[model samples]
Target: MPAQDHRAPPMPVVRLVVSDASHAYLDAVQRQIEQALLK
Candidate 1:
């Protein structure tokens, strides 16, 4: 019999910077957050 190793997979990290944003920038930021949550 062999012992099994249990370990959790690593999660990804996202970093971003927004300054003086417009509508497009806000939309992009929202999408990024959604994607991260889905993962």
Candidate 2:
């Protein structure tokens, strides 16, 4: 698996960083949409 590989390790780290950023962005957008709906 890519995660188990110790050599050439940048891929997993980059994937994690990108995933985290996207998740945070999506959460922020969801909150805004919810607020708009409630108003």
**TM-score per model over all chains:** 0.46, 0.79
Worst 10 residues of 1 by lDDT: 8-17
lDDT of 2 by residue, 1-39 (tens): 775676568888899999999999999999999999999
For candidate 1, lDDT tens digit of each residue in 1-39?
A: 123222222222111223334567888999999999999
Candidate 1 TM-score over all chains jointly: 0.46
- Model 2 pairs in collision: none
Q: Once superposed on the true structure, which residue ranges of model 1 sit more than 4 Å away at CA? A: 1-21
Report the Cα lDDT for residue 21, model 1: 46
TM-score (C-alpha, index-matched) for candidate 2: 0.79
The lDDT of each candidate is 0.55, 0.92
